[model samples]
Target: MGDLTLHGSVSPDSLKEVDQFDGQEMSAAEKARLEQIVWRKLDRWVLPIATIFYLLSFLDRSNIANARVAGMQTSLKMSNYQYSIALTMTYVPYIAAEFPSNLLLKYVGPRWMLPTMVTIWGLVATMQGVVKTYSGLLACRFFLGLMEGGLFPGLVLYLSFFYPRERLQIRVATFFASASLSGAFSGLLAAAITNIDGKGGRPGWAWIFILEGIFTFLFGFTCFFILPNSPATATFFSTKERHYVLARLKEDGAVSSDDKSDNFSWIEVLRCFKSLHVLMLTPVLFVLGVTLYGLAYFEPTIVAGLGYTGNKAQLMSAPPFVVAFVVSMITAVIADRYNCRGFMIIFFTFCNVVGFAMFYAAKSNHVRYGSLFLTITGCYCSAPPAITWVTNNSAPHVRRATSVAIAFIMTNAGGILATWLMGSLSPAPNYTKATLTNLIMSIASCVLACVNLAYLWRQNRLKAERRQLMTQADEPEGMGDESAWFVYKL
Candidate 1:
């Protein structure tokens, strides 16, 4: 079936299509045990594969920063400001097509969708190595972003099918930490690739894209056999296991079928825009996205400006991202254990606020660098949990899909703003404007976090009041979904 026809609320007809063998339902305890085993199996294959794919995607896209320092600009005769435009072009399509791509994923399926994207972008990445002029480079980067847009939102929707809302925080975190891994790895990879001297006279930066793109293309083709579409159609698991997984999901009030969500309500797309939680959460993610892209798009340039050689700057860039990855994992595990998404996110945003102030106020190079480490670590550490909470609170099926896609779409739109904030006109050695811009973004994120906390608290209070007035026989199905419920976690 086409993807657009593969989702929605579970109608009787739809349920019949997905109903498992024996028509037997298991107890809650049996469900729990099966979930444990399923997660173990999932961790073995799902997390690692998804994480690696995103890591490579991130690395290939952002390595241009490292390439800039590796003499890419000089070789191509592009100015510093032109580099920023190149970066902005990447986000153009990435933001424009994000939500639509999720809708498309309904029919295409990840088995085919993800790999096709990977293959397309991988080819683009390889072509990046061959670009001889500024326009050529811009064209490659724009196409790269266009192809990569579907990946994140699609994966977010895909993960929702297998994992319930409560268990998804750390899983999402694990996936997002791939960005930090890429941040660290990009430097090392660029360093190695920069050393490659081809007989054809291509520069090392070109080789970076070519080599990374090749792996991405190959991995995409491979994921077809590996990435499960949903509990309904997962090929790796036994039919009974698939049935068990589906039943467990019903317990969470998350609905699924082989039908497209667009079949039910196109207005559902706008529903996400109207949610208070979404409105507040989107800007918080927006600020963080800006910071992430700012760093990803320009970290190598910033490091190079610090008086280190290109190679040394790339090497130094690894440590801060390493710190971020470790901190992100720790935060994820803690948030999941406590079921306290809001508090942890606010805490991390606060850390960024402090880190940014420290960077802006500091005089010494050592102090400034230390502040940079803290800033990157804290903001990145919080992002996954914040995003996970936003997506999980949404309704099942298409609502969840649209909500998740909006979060990414909104966030990458901020990438465009961040790109413009640190214009190429700034002095090379001290990007005073960029540093201050990050500080502003950090503060903005913190403010958004607090606003969301308050909004969630108010909604919960209202819901509690509504419950108090309801008769025993009369209650709305606990908000939107039948089994899934939203509680303010702050």
Candidate 2:
């Protein structure tokens, strides 16, 4: 009776006797109950507020593509290449700003920092609507990137505070999928807003910026009241439930305290350079980012290639994004459920490769449009898992932050490069070169996935052999040297 009683009780005395602390024997029922508590934590606050925050941020940042076709380019008298430069400008500060911002997020608390950044970016996005000259537009784009830079990588780190490693990929995927919706929704929203061109002597593109920015500002205010700072500071749960979560998280080797340390330095920055994992991950992310950003940078041009009118082209862009949004979510769920990030990534990249190849080969508009759906779907599908794979392998909180920052910076750099490469020269009917480049990038990404897998397998084998040797010897307690012994997953 005493042993049976331990199974259901949460008393300190009972908890101490329940089982080993490895998290290996948590029965399905216990896990289900814990998950219910976690869900309650999520549905009550996390998902709703995060969705609104990220959705608005993403929409405001990316909606410029939609706004350009609506009227911004014409109103500002910018050429196709110049508009591409404007799009590329936003990523410049974004690439430079994420690491420092994440450090601030850790110190100042996300509740204040995230909301403040959102409001600032919201104001900047609104200001973008008012820009009359090329220089004004450039200034606004740079500032917009500066403000929105840390939100995503910071969000990933923030989410780790709430979820275990196994579950984080799905949640991150879900958060990122919000960006996909921005793509899908921005088209529809721009379609409606573009009709307001003559209403107040303002262009339809200005209205796109104004309306989306207002929505973003409002969401930011809401986030101030709703976003939880961390598990340590969370107030929604009862004290015992918080303790339960913190203790369980510790059992899983996910406690963030292990990574916290003194101020950053060039030495810490150089640490990432020494890791083979970062070496392997950077190129994969670079190519993936190039392909994804190429698609984003050129979506409007691609849609217009179908020989549609302006508004219809804006509206037609919606379907491919909608397809990508759905496919990405499904891929994330499957990858997280089975812990199969590497293989799933390879599969999705293969799909992207084939999709891009089809776009390059197809001659007819209908065939090209069909390929757009496939290309967007498959390329977007691979991103979540590929990113999650990187995150899952990185360790220690500070090191993980450095690793993700490196990947994100490279990705943003890719965005900058793709913006130029897919410029006016490749517009419609002759975008075959751009499409072929995307196909090659996708194929290269698949090869990296295989290389990563093989490396991880070799590392795992080494780890197992070391563990066996240690067990066979008589070593003192607490003799595990993390530097020599701990090997990260691929």
Candidate 3:
């Protein structure tokens, strides 16, 4: 057949039109097989490594919850308010560091920046173990936040360099699913580690931080060797294969060729701040962060209150994350397969609405426990699509980096709120204030999703209608995403 589509989306006409001077043309079947080979290579080398780093990132941050249940609060003599203060400390630097971090990520690139951030945060996480005083613990949390802040938005931008728009959600989801897996793994691992109480002059909660942090710290160095800076420099690919990868991205409108230019400027950062879409996205991202950190930093406590205790509560926490991981992957598969992003996001947010509602009102332990699954599923599934939506749409590498960073600030703000949500203040079981706040945030997120989708849909229509007059006549490398030719994946 003369007709062939890559990932069932890219067609021959657009491919040829965009890259008319491509080295050669092949039959549909030949092209399809080549793409499969390339994607497999990328998935093998890229996905797992990214997933690994993110898993550690999450584990180190959330393990504080595990520590709390294992007597961390008592050891440090922290009040609920004091504990909340420490939890909130991490996010302030985390949000503050994002803008500069985005600029640095662009200047240095992920190959170097990502591993460096991980290593520092990993060290900070390990320090969390050795903290003897409340002030000492607070300092560790603050620096940990500072170091870890950049990696997430950096990872989102990094993936865009390799994957096209149609294929982005699945790839983003695959690694983003690491958050859920990390949740599961953290609970299981914490149970085992915390059992070794009073080992080597350290409490059980201390080990939870020490061991996990050390592993994460060491793993960061390996990423420096493994991660390719960009498709252009990926050592695993032949020159020909590299060309094909770059061409595919350009043809798919995943990026403008000029996007690779090293023209990072303050103007680009300003544009991100000025972007209405990006601004609107901040509130949604804020809520997204709320749901995720709400569950993550507090789930162990939530489980402890649900008639489960000690290792049993930790064990119980794992299952919901496991389920969430599965739901996240499945949702991603469906979203990517249908080439639908916004609607899928809307659906996922609404799922969270139901989850938070049930979690707030349910009285039975079984019912309450079951609601955990819904909450995790909704939070984990929604993130990849949301990040993918922003990353896949923004153009000129600088703008994407800046937009994601801008939006991510709200996520850290949400983390700040989540730190105080339940904790010692609201207690456990019912957790009235926390539940009510989460419920309200979920409903707000749903509304924001609708608003974002409508805006995207309208933009898509306008772009489509004026398609005839669109041209890249102004800038040499292309006008970035501002070019009318750019297509939103909504």
Candidate 4:
């Protein structure tokens, strides 16, 4: 219950001593009580803000699809190819900005960085309503992507600083489930907002952007005052609670040497790139991104193709995502409780394969609609674990930041590819070719997940063997998953 002294900087050596003290001195019940207090505070203050931020981020990014159905494409005089290019443009800057933004988040701190970025993107999202030309729309979309890119990976990295690997999956799933809920909310909101189709001489599509953007901007500004940067700086916690937070994290092997350092290291960046797990896992995420983004961007349109149009199609889009949110949270809890991330990932991916295949081959509209539910459930459930896997394995703040960024960049690359792929499914009434392509991607993702699972199992076995030989003192301080005593959550 003693406080670790605070200073201008916390050295690795100091953190090591703190880690040792917390591990050896604290009794089991005392430790558990302190941990409960820390978790309750975090659940109250941190998780809700991060979840809401991401929900808005996704709503702003994907609301364009709803806008398109409300006649933005025709209003802007954009052809299918032009509209696709606008979507592609968003990913270009989005993919590029992720790594640098994550790095920046470390230096600037989440309190300032997250809300600032959200505000910028919110303004940009609002500007979409004013775009008179296709070029204007493209410009707005690109800027929106650039600003929004950092939030997801940044939140993931930020959450890592708070939670250990085993507990991280459920928290991440909760945040991700917000993204799914955003999809449902966006649909319902768009359906309602589009009802103001001709008010104030503006189309309903324009109104969608205007209203949602205003909501985002205000929320972002408010978050600047509310969100805490880290456990050390969080004002809501008592001194003892803050000490407990740091102690528990250190004992859980969550903190790292570079965590408090402002200096960026190229060596850490190179180390992330060289990791075999990261290299293999990036492609799996990439494929998932393709299907995920493609579906998010076009689910309304797809539902419209199934004989529902306008407001009804928008309303229909909500149910699939609602189902996805429920399924994702359930799967996340199971994955975390059982420590079975890889198996769960593979299982969900296989579900996607089945769903997509049915969507492609089924002759009945009801069957295809049911297939949407399956596909969304599978994709949404798998994503939290997939991203958490990278964060769970990568050591130190720098490597985790770089690895998460790289994974997202590659994944967003799939999104860039999806814009074109989904676009090519044009002549819109029936997207036979697009459905087949997504089916193929889902199958590929399942194959890769199986391969990755095998690799993780092997890695865990090796680590277990190594752990048997090493004494507790042999474990490296703040090395996270790379520590001799650390076991991969497989």
Whole-model lDDT values for every prediction: 0.74, 0.72, 0.79, 0.82
Listed per candidate, the RMSD to the true structure in angstroms reads 3.7, 5.8, 4.4, 3.8
**What is candidate 3's local distance difference test score?**
0.79
Please provide the root mean square deviation of candidate 2 (C-alpha atoms, Å). 5.8
Question: On lDDT, who's better, 3 or 4?
Answer: 4
Q: Using Cα atoms with residue i matched to residue i, what is each candidate's TM-score against the true structure? A: 0.90, 0.89, 0.93, 0.92
Which regions of candidate 1 are displaced past 4 Å?
1-32, 256-264, 471-490
Rate residue 106 of model 1 by lDDT: 66
Which digits, one per residue and each the tens of the lDDT, describe model 1 over residues 64-124?
8888878888999987678778988998898777878887776667778877888789889
The candidate that wins on lDDT is 4
Model 2 lDDT tens row, 1-490: 0000000001233233223234445566765676588657855667666666777877888788887778678788999889778978899899889888865666677889889989889999998888889889999999999999888777776776667667777777777777777778888899999888867767888999988898788778777887887766678876545656666555444452322232444554566677666677687788777777777757876788778768898888888889888877787777778788888778878888888888888778888888878777776777777667766665545556677788888777878778776776466655866777778888888898888888876876776677677542343322111222344443
Query: Which regions of candidate 3 deviate over 4 angstroms?
Result: 1-14, 17-22, 259-262, 469-479
Better of 1 and 3 by TM-score: 3
Error in Å for residue 403 of model 3: 0.7
How does candidate 2 score on lDDT?
0.72
